[model samples]
Every structure is written in structure tokens, then in C-alpha cells.
Target: MEVLSHFVRVSISEYFRNLPVPDSFVGFARLTGTEWLTLLPFVGTVSLLIYVTIQAFKAKPVPEDTKVNRKIQKESSKVVNMVDIEDLGDKVSYCRCWRSKKFPLCDGSHTKHNEETGDNVGPLVLKRKGAA
Candidate 1:
């Protein structure tokens, strides 16, 4: 994107003055009509990208969520139980403890959750025989 943007800013369109472009860096010439037509796809892709980028910068941001919007979002959010942890057996009477500060089994609370998306609960089962 940066390279293409730079090319556009530099106005490289004049390079197409004739089909047999004499750009020093690349010696591409004597290309057939099909070869030239193949370039159109790349040109169209780059043009669309540039156009969309310009539009993105020019377009104003949408209005902030109003109280009503917030309420709706909150209500809709209640249905998300994406991290529902299943039963991890008993907590006590087993005579085992979690290595993590979270204690008990684990929600991976002790593990670094830099990229983990779910609840930081671990899969480690606390090996205990008594109440946790």
C-alpha cells in the first residue's frame, strides 16, 4: 500500500504514455495485448485500494452510541456465554491445590494470557480429596 501510494503521489500515470514503457528499472516491452490486459486487473485493484483509502480518511466517523444504543448492546451482550467452563470436578477433599494464585483447579489464571481470548481458566484439575 505504501509503495502504491507513493507511486500515485509521484504521478506515475505518465509512464503509460505508450504501451512500450521505457521505465529504466524494469525493461518490460513488446508485451502482447493479453499481457497488457492482464495489467488491468492489478491496476484496478490498486486503484480501488487508493480510492477506498482516500474515502476512509475523508469520511466522518459515525455518531457515538447513545444511551439507547448502549442499552441495546448491553442487552444483546447478555446472550454471549462464550467462555462457559465445565465442571472441573470437586474443589476439596482431593488434597490438591492450584499452582496459580487463582487456587483450586485453573482457569489458566496463573498462565500469561497475552493472546488468549477465552476466560483465563486453566485445564489443570486440582487433585484434592476434601473441600477446597
Candidate 2:
């Protein structure tokens, strides 16, 4: 039957022409029972999640200036005091008459050449005691 398939169409002028739209909250309540039920829980949950994310972005990071390990690493690098002979001359010059089989790099023969009582350690020995 043609009447069974036909839908009842309401005109926009007659159905909504007299409604107070902009000044009333009832205009926003145009949802069906099923649509309202489905979105009710999700609306509040999403609002709270957005609020938490905004708060996290506004937080400041903690400043740390007294980092001991970083300071020690920086200072220890300057204290090694090793030199290259290729730019100068024989490696024996750095150790000051101390012999090293490794040539350019000192093998700590200066530690044994001079008395241990003094602070006269070769470059290689100083590096072994934690160099940069």
C-alpha cells in the first residue's frame, strides 16, 4: 500500500517557526531516548579527561642545579693532562726521561722512575684513576 511506506513530513515553518530557539535550553534537548542514554555517561567522562590534560600541560618542570656526578665528570676531564708527541717530538719528553713502549701514549713509567712520595705520575697512570 502507498500509505504504509509514506512518511509523515512536518513542515519547518509550522513545526519550528513559533519555537523560542536561542533563548531557551529546551531547543538543545532535541535528542531521542536512545541517543541521550548512549551519550550521557561519555559526556561527563570526556569533560573530566580534557580538564586533567589541560592541567598537566600547564605544570612546570622541577629545576636541578646541584648535580654532583655531572660536575665531577666535567672537572675530571680537565685534570688528566696528557699531550701528543706527533705535534711536538718523542713521547719521552712528556714523561720527562721516563720510557714507555707504547710510544705516543704514556705507559706510566714515570710513576716508577720518580719516588711515589711526590705527585709525579705519568699521563697513562692518571687516566687509569678515572679520566674523562
lDDT of 1 at 20: 55
Q: What lDDT tens digits, residue by residue, belong to model 1 across residues 1-132?
A: 999997886646654543353356355565667767856766788899999999988968776731222222345545222322344455412112133333332444334532443334335344436745
Give each model a TM-score.
0.24, 0.22
> What's the residue-level lDDT of 67 in candidate 2?
38
Clashes of each: 20, 0
User: How many Å off is the CA of 8 in candidate 1?
Assistant: 25
Best by TM-score: 1
**Model 2 lowest lDDT segment of ten:** 89-98
Model 2 C-alpha lDDT per residue in residues 14-115, reported as the tens digit of each score: 434433333466745875666556555556687999999999898676657333233223545442445553554322333332344554346666676457
88: Cα error in model 2, Å: 54
